[model samples]
Target: MRPDLLLHRWSSSSVVILLGFAELNFPFISSLHIHVELLRGFCSDNPRNQQYPSARIKALERKMQKLGEFKLPHFFNYPPYFTLQPVRDTREKQIQLWKELILDYCKSQKTFVIAIEEEFPLFTNHVIERSLTHEAKETFLSALVSEGRAEWMDKGHRRCLILWHRIQDWADILIQFAKDNGLEDGVVTIEEIRSGPESQGTELHGIDRTILNRALKLLEQKGKLVVFKGTSTDDEGVKFSI
Candidate 1:
């Protein structure tokens, strides 16, 4: 058989095998299991194997270690990972995975920003020479936008602000900081958090000014914090109540 034909045959059989698992009616676990088995089959069937199933499983296992919920391992050198589907159920799962992966990658790397044309390490697989096309990247990120977990950084989505940690998380961080640092009843300049030595090297270090402001505003709406201005936008301070 031609190498291409052999691979194609293997892929088709794997899909059938995956569907067999998916067809099992065992509730939540069935879907999860199906996804896992599908990944297993996909990895195992690769002709490049020197160690067969063990090597494939180990490779995927390592890839998945870096990802969080709904996120798959970085090993999706396969082309299917990039395509957004019209199939309702599959699309939902794929979207969920993309959201989780994007968030995980951003949070761990402290990537607060994502650009459409830029090469996101999360979106590329040099091991297989595959990268997300612009449309695919937008599709995944737009899913986040719809769910209130992401936003476009501009009129065009060429630039995006990824809220992997979310505004609520940012608010929680502020609340915790307030409680920990005895700022609950006191006030300090926003610049102090954004640039002062106090926040340096912490998660707050070098945070984008806009994200900091948004997080503060979220806290303000809850009446847990108040923002007051003194000299400039950078000099704004917050007073937290309890």
Candidate 2:
């Protein structure tokens, strides 16, 4: 018999042999038969040997490890995902996903701001050589802004302030902080609420001054607290009533 034909005949007979063993109830034979079927299916489905390079695969794995517990969605690797979809429904869904991802990533990294033109790790997939275009970035960030999850820092919309926790949420947190630290009726400097020892280790620590001001203003509107201007902006004080 010709070599090719002989090999083909053997391949056919091998399945039969495995099936016979499986039917005989041999230990492990059934699993072996299943694996053989899976291997055959894989070979048939990927006849072109389409597979990512080993080095690229390893590089992606390392990059994921560096993300440090922030798990990216599987679709993040899809090439088309990097491009803004033209279809209305598709674009909406894509924008929603991007908004969620941006919020989640910023929260995980404690990232308070994102410059549209700057290099944000979440905006790029080095493994696939894909990154969001400036327009796409703005689109996604705009969606976030509409939902009150983020704010544009400049009139040009070049910079965005991420609010994983909304102003109301931050106000609630501030109230809790006051209750915890017994500052409900006491005066506290703005700096103290930001970097004071009492605020250390809390979400208030190292908060963006802009966001801090916004949160304080919301509390002021509700009469929950009164902000007192001092000699300098950093010298501002707050007197909590609740």
Candidate 3:
């Protein structure tokens, strides 16, 4: 066999092996294959030395642009990150990072809830065509729940309330809101506090009603405020003593 032909055959076989490893979800091998695939054209003797076709380049650019203002971390594209790790230490670290990322993403986007069955941007990496499995999503969110950073909205765990700001934090924010709006010694309706002009443009605006009620209850317990139930739910009012 010719030396050049043998080299070509060996290279082709190596590529196949790398792709096989990638298909098996080996992160390091998959990453290596991706790099090789991206640079193969540049390494070849093509006159243009173009790394990829124009259409592919444009597609990549569009994917990046679609990410918008929320900058995803580099690890998001790592396929294994989407899977639930079995090792205790590794899984703990993964869960911790996922919790922080979920909180940060929800805070940035002002997203208050995450439906497990729904398509969450943070749960999918389009660039790598990877997504968190149902079990993996539940595991990470459960970790957050254990830490009081999130809550299961239903007994089935299909819906999650992401408390980027904890109940205590929200209560503090409520106190500040009262002071800011000169309602520290006055009364305001529950609905008004949620969507009124004073609440608009603040973090309290558009807060999930469940979370808002929890915060209000906490404040009520502290004797900082008194919640009065009205004939109509929307007319329920709070009197601030602070």
Candidate 4:
């Protein structure tokens, strides 16, 4: 150790020395000791951490982005993201956000069905390694069903089909599309529109059968498409009319 450097460093701050000395002085010493004792007591009982709030706020920000609402982030700032939400309003709002995000993501990706048992893109935050628990997924899907935008294709919500566009909207699209493709009074195989060249790359592509059936039923109720058994064809097909 260099004596000159040690002297220079020690002499750097007079205030630090004074403050240190003040802690030993009788009047200031008692106050400082009381404060230290209080702090130590508090720490021993329950530590006040600065990290807890910062981590909490960051998680809140992520959930708020899912909400896509104009309100401040703290409205939904809660600790239960790690624990599944249980309160009715909180769970409702949480489910609403999840539903909206799922639909929005699907609309962007043209994903018409969400397999509840499968890993969904928005459900996992790989950076955080957090995902919706199975129960959370079911709750959100149930919320969508209550709103008519999603359906449980099976009794078990192992597969929930999403419809960013409602079945009514799809029926309208079918009517317009039938007119566009000159099927106003014509017959086409269900498979042809579902996966064949004519439906390639269209909204009709990659659509779940249950969703298609719902849409078809919607149109049938409106007298647009008629379902009939095809004895000759392998697929019992449908015919459409304007």
Candidate 5:
């Protein structure tokens, strides 16, 4: 075999091996080069020189645009965001950004609940073909739970209750809602508070039942309301005496 041909074959194999390693998320990959000696042996010239920075930037911009209310930082598209940063400072920033993004997404979308095994739109970026690893998802969600902004619905952490608004805040809102509807000393069913015409066009509309129950319990403790049990568990009602 010709010496030049052997070199070409070796370089091609080397490039493919390095790319495979990268795809597999190997830690050692700083040795891959794009120079002629590397690509001239096997790969074409045009693709080596074409930088894809713009693709990443545009992909990130399109994602934020699609999210509508989830405004991402400029560094969101900087490639490294997809990886778990090893450095303490960088990892802290990354985690903080993820935390803020999750809360902002939940708040804007009125998403009170998130199941880890379910398809949550914020967990994946389709344009970039990037999705959060299960570990990453749990890590970010745990951070939110630590800060009291979220809670695990079960011990296994399979589901999460995202409280973009605190229970106290929600309770206050419910009290104000009741007052606005002239419901002081009036009775209202749980279903009515969730889906009735009076709740329509308000934040209370389609609220998660669990969160509503927590808010109601808070008000009940404060003597603002009395919950009455019914024949069916789903038919619980609240009588406001405020």
Candidate 6:
């Protein structure tokens, strides 16, 4: 049998194979089930064969290790996912995946802020040598902002404030924390609610002051809390009404 026909016959094998042929019109095999060493030997003598897949696989493995606790979906390893898909349905799914991955990464890392020009781990894949462009970054962030899961920090759009929990949800959490600590109708400094002993180890601890203020304002509008600024700007306080 001719080598081309033999290759076509072996293409259905489960093993991954990278074959390079000089003839562009040849009916080449898309996959192979043969041993990798055998395939390597077949291509070893061919000067035109390009070794691309192994390096790509190695890079992907490195990226997986860098993910830490963030679990990447299977499609994340697919190279096409790094580009903006042109098809409507495929692009929709791609955008959705980007949104989910961004939110998950932020929540896992406790990342409340994302600066556009800054180096963010989630925005780059060192393994695939792929990274989201500025437009792609804005598209994903804007989707989250539309859903109230994030906000633009400034008019220049250089930064974003990620809210894994909506402002209303944070308000509810704050109220629950106050009630649990017997602070209902009691006063606490804004700073205390953020880093005081009472807030330590709780979801309220280390909360962003801007987010906290927004949550408090939401509650205040609903008569659930009162925010009063002391004479000193640093002495702002909140009084919960249960």
Across 100-172, the per-residue lDDT of candidate 6 in tens digits comes to: 8888888777788999989998777655467888888887888889888999999988999999888988998
Q: 116-228 in candidate 5: lDDT tens per residue? A: 98888877766545677888889889999999999998999999999999899999999999999999989999999999999999999999899999999999999999999
Q: Rank the models by lDDT, top first.
A: 3, 2, 5, 6, 1, 4
In the range 100-186, model 1's lDDT, one tens digit per residue, is 878877877778889899877778754334577888898999999998888998888899888877788888887887787788798
| Lowest lDDT block of 10, candidate 1 | 23-32
Ranking by TM-score: 3, 2, 6, 5, 1, 4
Q: What does the lDDT come to for candidate 1?
A: 0.68
Best by TM-score: 3
lDDT of model 1 at position 174: 76
Model 6 lDDT at residue 198: 90
Higher-ranked by TM-score: 3 or 4: 3
Query: Model 1 misses residue 10 by how many Å?
Result: 7.0
Q: Per-residue error at 31 for model 1, in Å?
A: 16
Best by lDDT: 3
What is the model-wide C-alpha lDDT for candidate 3?
A: 0.77
TM-score of each: 0.67, 0.76, 0.78, 0.61, 0.73, 0.75
lDDT by residue (tens digit), candidate 3, 1-242: 96434444444334433443353343233354353344343334433444445555456445633356887654564566777778776677677778888998999888999999999998887765679999999999998899899999999999999999999999999999999989889999999988999999999888889999999999999999999999998999999999
The residue pairs found clashing in candidate 6 are 13-33
- Give the Å error, residue 83, model 3: 1.4
Q: Where does candidate 2 stray beyond 4 Å?
A: 1-52, 64-69
lDDT of 4: 0.60
Give the TM-score comparing model 1 with the true structure, all chains together.
Answer: 0.67
* TM-score preference between candidates 5 and 6, better one: 6
For candidate 5, the per-residue lDDT at 220 reads 96
Model 5 TM-score, 2 decimals: 0.73
Using lDDT as the measure, name the better of candidate 3 and candidate 6: 3
Off by over 4 Å in 6: 1-59
Write down the worst ten-residue block by lDDT for model 2: 24-33
